[model samples]
Target: MKPLALPSGSRWSAAHLCGLSVVLVPTCFLAVLFIWPVLRLLALGFGDEAGPFHSYLRVFTVPAYREAILTTFEIAIAVTVLSVMLAYPVAYLMATVSPRMARLIGIGVLLPFWTSALVRTTAWIMLLERYGILNSVLMRAHLIRHPVAFVYNMSGVLIGMSHVLMPFVVFPLYTAFRGLDRNLVQAAMLLGAGPLTLCRKIFIPLTAPGALAGANIVFMSALGYYITPALMGGPAQTMVSQLISFNVSEQLDWGMAGALSGVMLVLTLAAFFLCRGVLEKRLKRRVVTAARPYGEGLSGRSGAGWGMVIAGCAVMVFLLAPIVIVFPMSVSASPILMFPPHGLSFRWYHELLSRPQWAGAFFNSLKVALIAVPVATVLGTLAAIGLARMKGTFAQILEGLFILPMVVPAIILAVGLYYQLTPLGLTRGYWGLGLGQAVIAMPFVFLTVQATLRGFSRDLELAAMSLGAGWFSVMGRIVLPALMPAIVSGAIFAFITSFDDVILALFLTDVRARTLSRLIYENVLQDVSPTITAVAVLVIVLTLGLLLSSLLFQREKS
Candidate 1:
């Protein structure tokens, strides 16, 4: 039978209805599963006068809680400053280097992101401990007669967190630099502008938006950070996240915990908007200035400028030192954290394998992330495509809704999920953990895939249909192939996010479904062991392997 054709200008075709249904499924799923839960948690923050309000008043009225809030902001600001300083040169190199070198530097920035935050924080513990590698190296070199007090202090927290947050700064700056029109820089040079003049007058202004964005991203993420400060910083350096966790777990004060969480959310949002406004204003001013076009005189550097470039490279190495230190420490068999390892051995690798808890958690994380990755990728990619195809207030709203997960604090999301999923029989199971992870993973997938889809044209699909291909067949043979690069990239991101996430997993996982990150958290908080570094190294290796394989696969396919 011939397929029935919809009338001209009709908006109710079967294909359109199918598209709507597909979009609606995930939209409804998010509303019921994510939005409602978060709203409920927010509601708890403003409980009756005798409950959360009283707790909030006590918290606000108390000097201790106020100090924690101040400490959190202070640390976040310090981290942001350090990250920008360390990342600027790496980003500059990425923007101005040979394509091969650029790709290598980009990989360096991305590698840390693939590993779990808990693992990274624990690795810092081994490196910063009195008996740790850093102290041993300095003592042996006669740089210091005694081990330095590095760990359990603000210095360690700053170092570990700056390492973790640097990538956020680098990636955005790299993108901004890449976005620059080379011709504009050349034009400035052709007009006899010195390197300093060109940079101050041209390059810096153009990249300021990215710098601002990256700094805000780093600061906001650092504000809510739990692992690094918990592992590396002492009581004196405690941040608000630690305070909230303490209230919930140690004090069993849910009301105050919720109130504190709400406060954090408000502060983060305010900071983000404030930064965004300043960036937008600067960008508007730059646009109005109407700078000269690029590519007139593109080569040659002044001697003074070259010195600055060398200084930038030096800073990059400094930022990389801690991560670079982890390798030798992981292989040490001295039964202690010692630099140069005293002598290297594979004993830690053996120990990592022998520990059933560690091995079990690793496998469980792998299983859950493997399931979540593809599911999130497919859903997120389709949602991006569907949203792009439509145009209206509804489409814009839906797109914003899809991206909301990334902006919301993970702990807030976790608390909400804990309460909401319990009654639905999803709590404390693989399903619960996976679903919660997918919610967090979805925004990243959507962002990457949407950016990719923006460059794609729907004409290919129309052309395929005109040649007698059915919708599914065209999508499979043509559309999917075109989207493979984006799908792979988005899926890798989703997988890593699910693999490394601790907050949601902590709230959702039971004994039967614990993830590697949770295991690291438990080991650090309950039992500090050398074995933690071994597990951390393994996680880093696994993530690097996955990322390398994905890149190689993409290269071969292209």
Candidate 2:
């Protein structure tokens, strides 16, 4: 749809002013709540008493800090490479398979993707620990005399991070694959081009931009990752995020924390822009070279080779392994985490409810989501509507500002808010944390609603207005109902974002008001219990339910 045009003179002025007002609500909300605190935090790093660059100089000079920064880039690069490589076979399979099989394959990728990171990490620990299920099975098979070390090492760190991040690459590659011309592949095959030659000459070049885009995202996200490395990695594998957390929680060093945050923020932005530039150039080149002639007698579909099919199946198993393992383990009667159950029982489920701390944390998560989701939805919807009506560089700038919360690392936001609110005593309850989560959740809602509005018909609103209806009446009776599917989709995303967050909860709320994710993280650090497995199962179920609900809404909209 084209941009909405307005009437001349005072009418245009009125409409323009109205759009500005609608945009201002979310702008001011983010400005005061998100942008101010982060700026304050960054300023702390540069304004130290010793000198402007004192904290930064120390970050480079200190051996522990220097090694952490290097290790962070190293792990991020490794995870990026692994994710891109593992994504290709699965993406290819999805694009080539029947629709039903593709949906099944998608569920395998997305079920774990949608679930909480903490839960997946916990499941990995159970499967890969020294005396864990994998080792036990291998020993029983006489494959090895003793358990292989998996968790609490570099190997464990790579596995956990790659599993968590590979979906970032898969979806993009799937899109790129689906857009490929089947005629090109069939023509090459008719010329007796083998699978390896076809892939190297045609498929790889066509998909390179998408792969690079995915790699960029994985690398940036990995830079800010805290939970996986903290739980799975040994001391030598520590990343910059852990250092920032340590300075704030353990060392009482705000300046150092701020300096580390600054470094991460710079690196993340640099990677984003650099990758974006490369992708744009690649897209332009593809467009210029995309004038391929259609091949006659090429109706037959190209299928993945046996090797590709086997690799794709293996990747599907890897994606589903953690989620699948948690179910049987949750029902195990044994206090220890064993694969085959001593007996099937709901004892862990009972423990989950009977414990006061567990019950309280669950309810706290609900209360915070209740407060955050609606606020994010309202602010995001209004921002989308206002932005859709707008045209110019000013609107583009505002859009960027609106999305900055998502681009900036969550740890930075958490620490900034912690520094800003701790002094005002606002960190004592769920309200502050709810608002902090709203900052992160709003961007998802904005992006979803904005895309929906692009396809929405403004003619209905104009028709309603022409019939003597007021703006409020038109929006309430006409616009919102039409946008309900998108609204619900955005709300689900916002709900999950708020519900699954741990970083903000760690810093913004104390023990008395902690969230479930935070409590799970703490418990995993202290002990690996059967009850945690039960909780993981529940979280997975909840996430899949929400995902299904979103899909249902989209189908209904169609």
Candidate 3:
């Protein structure tokens, strides 16, 4: 069949219009819904005619606020370092394994991510409580005289955070490792390089960008974390998020909250730019080295070094321990969390079911996420397709704008939504919460779908059009099938993001619209219950199942 050729100028103009529309819609949406609200909130920090800038100045001058900032950074850095160290080996294993094994391992790493952060944080609380499993086991074996203070402190906060953040590090590193040229490693070995030398000179350098990207993500996220630290850490260990929440809700001090949020926003942007600069440098270096022949002859020791292998396995286990400890504690018959339960029972699970509030909250969360996921996914995919096919500066700017949700702090978004939605008669309802979640979820969907579109050739779409199909027909028949995997992946991410969200839900929810994460937050703060542990376990199971299903589907397609 002959192609339908359009004049070059007309084609370019059409592309420009398409791009402009793509960029304009999202840019307008974000400007109204996200950007304006945040700017308005930040304006509160400067004070109105009623008062001076004393509140902002006071917060900055206070030692307590300074300590909070320092503590937040300290914990974020620690979590980033720990998450990377643990994620590297798992990523390597995933990279080197058979396809089937890699898929299974990938599913395993993603499992924790499906569970809500609040649920995961409470699980850590149960496991690290004074009479929790760790202490119970140690005491039973006569290893200690009294229960250790693991929970309600910095140690517990770090352990819980690292567990939750590990998957972020693993996924990026896994992707990077999978994309590595195996020939390069073999070439290094052939050049007589030792194992350590190969790792230092070749593997490490190659994977550094992924490592940096993952670490930056973890660090940025950890900085704004509220639930985990609030649940696991005591008053002394409070992070900046908690402080911001306290100012807004407890003290009714909007000025300080706004200032703190602005500070966090600035810091986050700085970290992102710093990471971008480092990545650009690494990419330039890689480009320079592209023409070099693969180095060979890395030193071999006893066929893959069992000692290093064992150490790596041990680290994996350590990373996974917090999650592993939750099962026994939930199933324990004893009211208090204990290890090797005197007798196992389903009491906690039954408790979770019988409790009306917990069960109701679960259903509420499910309903909201189910509704938000599909809506966000479709919108995001449409935007991605339009941007990909269109050629204009407007399209590029819009694509970037669509992903701004990733950079903005959820707490700030929550505060903004709380203020804006109230006037629209949307606050404290399911619709309000769902809307807020969709705003955040859309960005993930956009990224996933856009990446998927980038991988596909536009020739199929052109061919379909040449066959006399209309625009809709070409998209549905040709582009849709090719982009199905990405759509599904993006939908899954949207679902999980909504399911795991706490900050937005916390602000926008009243009793009737409370989400599971919000419910878990209340339970942890009000009364840490075994019922919460049961809920946490159920969340973990559901998430794992969803992740496994996604992997299986992807594997079958492959």
Candidate 4:
């Protein structure tokens, strides 16, 4: 049955009177900033800019364009499969291990998750280069005489995509595994079910939520991947996103760009529906009662258990190695970038300040992030409060609309924002790009605040109302202070999300406002600068500090 539209309270009571104003303000903001721009882009594509079918027709007719679409599908699917295989065992280990051990291992898993995806991709680029670390090691071992062509090829694209998307796979599976009942397994074992049968019938069904949801997240996210493939993939490996960007910026072919984006959007929606259906059928809530001994639990130290532990450690190493490689590369004394450095020097770090372009990009990212973060934090916090207090389809629909920006490939938002901003001369500087990023950052902010609200006590709200405090007074004196940790975490996340962006920067910024990620992106393509590694290291440090602060705050709140 559909949920009723309002909560079980007086529509105008003090407790609920802050009410829809909270929803309306953010809803209106998203409407202007996100929905309108996307709808505009779609209209322009199918509109009379030449003809409705002009661009759509080209995607179908052109051989290279057709291949780009097919290759994108292949890469996304491969990334989905590889990430799950690598992440599942680690997630299981975390569920079964001691609390302290799980915490230690979780930090290893999350460092890469919280750090910039583009930074990680850049590190992989350096590692896989002709004179890069992997080749240097392989040659020293007499494995091969010449460096393999890893970058500007399909192999490089796959590795980058897998590294960046692995965390999405790990986090959801960890959640589901932690929530599973060990007692059920003991009950099944007592009923004469063997290990294989227990896994096939009980465990797999229980974990369906994480496996299916995480794969859908990875595959959909990969579908619009641009920077990794643009840098790592060869000319023959052009993707739908690259195709859209090229047509819009280079060819002035709006129709074709729109058609390609429309198709990608459709593909994203289709995959989500198909995955959701499977998850629902397999993961329906069920009652299973059982008792268990402490020593003999969900995962025993049988041969199979030992095998999984070994595999989980290996997966953790694979996930962490690429991110860890960049720090050593940054301080190398070689004029050219090198790993296993001949000598360590801070020259590249100093050079960042001396170079005008690098300084400009760094400051530009800061400016954009500063302007965007507070706005996203307020709007997201308010939306979370509103949705938590309300009920039914209207609230659900509004929440879904806010999250729409996250579900669509970022390339779609880039195209739409560029089109909407250009006509008003808003594309040249920080305001346009800042608004674009606020849209991008909204979901992170909303989700963080929403998670905190789920566990909040309604009794405090009721007490304040009984004492005759107004909604605004209750919010100012009670709720805001209570939610300080989550609010701050959400703001920090919004800041990094804007700062680390490159897709919108590629489309929206001119020479005056190119962001840090854009500069790294442009430099990696033209030349492998030592400064690129230095900048990545600096970003890694800043992001880690921010992440650690958020974690500490959450711990204190708990």
Candidate 5:
């Protein structure tokens, strides 16, 4: 018996239908939750009663709004510069160290990176406030006559924002360093180049693009940042995100909020596109040099002077200080935060456990993560698979569309979703928040699965199908098994994204429905409590565990 073949047109139609089926859910999900809300936001901004562009005109003409916009730019640029300056030394250290030592240093960098931004900001507050740990230590040692004002100022804002954003610079610069040609460096040294000269002539030139790329990310992220500045900076340091939040929540001015979000959205997308261009060029250059394995012909140690090592180590200490300080602070018997923490006790831990709000919020976060992660995983995995099968300009466009949630600011999404969902009463439950989180989480899953698919062999599927296996059989037996590790890693990331979310919870959940992060934010805003220290430590531990699990899956995949 022979198998009957369908006509070419019929086969094309079937394939097209299959493609649509795969992408349908994710596309609709993004459209309703993300695109529609954004569109509505823009509509509100433009359709203001005063005039067609009244909101936008107000953004530029109004003194307070104008200053806020200028302040946002100034802070973003400052943070970008600070992040790049601090990150270079750390990146250089990571690139030059032994693999084991590098991994240890990586943990220090990632502990803060993976930890909630809110937690980090809180930790900084405890460290830098008047009579806080750092000031206390300084006064005890007679380094100062008084407790200096370390927070609630521009200095505090810069420190907090820079610490959080620096990791963006570090990773990219590290990659660039790893990709540097060791032979070129050795040759330059043999020709009597000193460390400083070698750095100026070769290292700086080669790594500048990566640093700039990271700077762009830092700047773009800093532009929309809310938690750090709102908590750490004073009125003078007010950013656009805070302004948008204030307009929406305090002033009940949706038009102004929408306008601010539009400007932020435009700037973020522009920066994202520019960064993509640089990265694409950098990747192309890397491919051209693929004959040599990265870090090839390089010694474990470089000609880095003691000064470079000290700078690198200092940066590492700076990165880990807030995290390290929180542990002892959490255990302090004293009510006030201080270095060495007087006597050791776990009263804060006890207090945290005793609070119903803490426990309720913890479980609420879990509930949302449980809902978001699975939905994100399934939709992202399907989207990845469908996208992999697709070709031409449409697929390219669709790929960009899929990534918009990540590129757009969280505040914009939070505000927009609140607007779109309030009318339908969807904002009243965990369901809406969970779905909102899924919008952000889906990109991580999509990118991970899509990367895995790039290395997958389609011939295996073809062979199975040619042997009379169905599509489901091929996917179940071959594709899914190959993609499992990536799927798991993606899910872990999705969970983290949902668990650490405060912005979404702020708008999406009322008091009863608040998550752990939202509760922490409230505590920070209302008053500093010893219980928050304990909570921060717990959050750090949980985030670390999730990150490590993701790393293991990545290792398995590799």
Candidate 6:
């Protein structure tokens, strides 16, 4: 669609006023609920009368806080490196195989991506438990005489985080490979290069930019991890985010929390720009120049071709293991959350069905998503329309303002909203949590709608307007129908993003406003029961259905 035409002349004129009207709801929504709240939290860091930097000194000097800072970066680096390693071959296979095979393995890779990180973390705990399937297999085969301790440790944290983050790495690499030229591999082979030699000297170097980009994504995302570490890790594994939460909720130290949050925000912003800066632009151009159709030059040798495919399959299985393992575990007759059930049955699932708390969580999640998604979709669509027609610094600034929720970590938002909302008596109810979720979910809708609108035309709208159709009629009859698919896509994603959230809910949810993720977190920490397995299975299946629906929608669009 063509960009919407900007109103001309004075800012107070009717046309300009109308355009500004489109910006009011979202801008004010983000301002009062999102931006002002964050600004308030940042200001609170200096509430200490000792000095402006007093809270900073405390965070840096305190051993507990110091350790969280160090642990955050350490885990982020490890997660990024491993994600790159595991994801590369699968991405390569996706780019090289037939479309059907690509789609099959791609779903395997995406199963964990679409599922909640909370669910995946829960699944990992079960998978690595002493009586879990992994240990049972090893024990029966004599690989080990006893089950190993895997849950509640750094090992479990890594496994859970890696499963969650691998998809972030895969997507950029897959996009990069889709644009890669195959002739480089063929040329290298024709020049008498062996498989390893060609891979190292030609393919690896060409895709190095993609790897770097993917690593940046993994690192930044992992830096803000809360649920995985909280559930799967020990005391020593606490990250900077958990430290912030602890300072606020347990210790009642908002100043220190704000200071620590400030440090994180600065670092996150710096890294965001660094990752998206000039180097990324150059890399994008290279990827595009390198782009070619799949399967042209992927098969150079019997050993190398089959070996890479096998590696990819293994990696894909690793990605899907946590999601797939939960199904049978859910039905296991053992009420103690063990594997190799005393017998096969649906005992846990039946128990889950019997719980009112579980039902409340389910309803609460739907309630939040239902309230948030539509508001986000409409305002985001309006923002997209306004942003489409604006120009220069004004447009860039507005666009970035809307995207701040996505760029800043959820921990910061949680802290900000708590400090700001509590003062106004807005923190205790569903409205508070719903508004926060809508702000976070808003950017998702805006970006997706904008993406589709980039290729869309408003010529039909112009034609209808000229033919004397009113604004509503044009919107109702022509423009909305054209953009409805994009709206639906964005709303679905926004709903999932809101529904799968744990960090924001942790800070904002009250007794009556509890969500599914909160319930899962509570169960993991206190109950350690088999009902979590049933919950995980249900969540995984719902996510799978969403993924398939998205795929079918895309297929239809294409």
Highest-scoring model, lDDT: 2
**Evaluation by TM-score, superior candidate among 1 and 4:** 4
Cα lDDT of model 6 by residue, 302-349, tens digit? 677778778988988788787877787778877676666678998778
- After superposing candidate 3, which stretches have Cα over 4 Å from the reference? 1-12, 22-24, 48-56, 175-196, 288-304, 391-393, 555-558
lDDT for residue 190 in candidate 4, whole number 0-100: 87
CA displacement after TM-score superposition, residue 30 of candidate 5 (Å): 0.6
Misplaced by over 4 Å in model 2 are 1-17, 288-304
The per-model lDDT (C-alpha) reads 0.78, 0.89, 0.78, 0.84, 0.87, 0.81
lDDT of 2 at 150: 90
Question: Whole-model lDDT for model 5 versus the true structure?
Answer: 0.87
Each candidate's clash count: 6, 0, 17, 0, 0, 7
What TM-score goes with each of the models?
A: 0.89, 0.94, 0.90, 0.93, 0.94, 0.92
| Tens-place lDDT digits, model 1, residues 1-558 | 996888867766555555566578668767977889877766766784686477678667899999998999899999999888777677776666667877886777777766677777776676778877678788888999988999889998998889888888888888777767776766777999987797799777787788889999899898888778887889999888888777766886667777888888888888877997898787777643324222223355568556656866775665555556677777877886666676778888888898788889988998788767876887898887777666556677788789877767787788778878888888766888887888889888888878878888889888988999997897789878877877887888898899999888878888778988888888788756767767776777878887887788778877
> For residues 1-558, could you state the per-residue lDDT of candidate 2 as single tens digits?
985665674444555667788899999999988999999988889978999999999999999999999999999999999999999989877876777888888878988887899999999999999999899999999999989999899999999999999999998898787767767777898999987898899889888988998898899899999999999999999999999999999999989999999999999989988998999988887853333322222234445565676798999898898888999999999989888878999999999988999989989999999989999999999999888877667888899888888778899999999998889887989889999999999998999989989998989988988999998998899878878889899999999889899899999998999999999999999989999999999998999999999998789888
Preferred candidate (lDDT higher): 3 or 6: 6
Could you tell me how far off, in angstroms, the CA of residue 391 lies in candidate 5 after the best superposition? 2.4
Error of 5 at 540 (Å): 1.3
Residues 442-540 of candidate 4: C-alpha lDDT, one tens digit per residue: 888899888988888979988998999987898998888888899999999998899889999988889889999888888878887888888888899
Q: What is the overall TM-score of model 1 with all chains considered together?
A: 0.89
Runs of candidate 1 exceeding 4 Å displacement: 1-20, 49-52, 179-199, 277-300, 526-528
Worst 10 residues of 4 by lDDT: 287-296
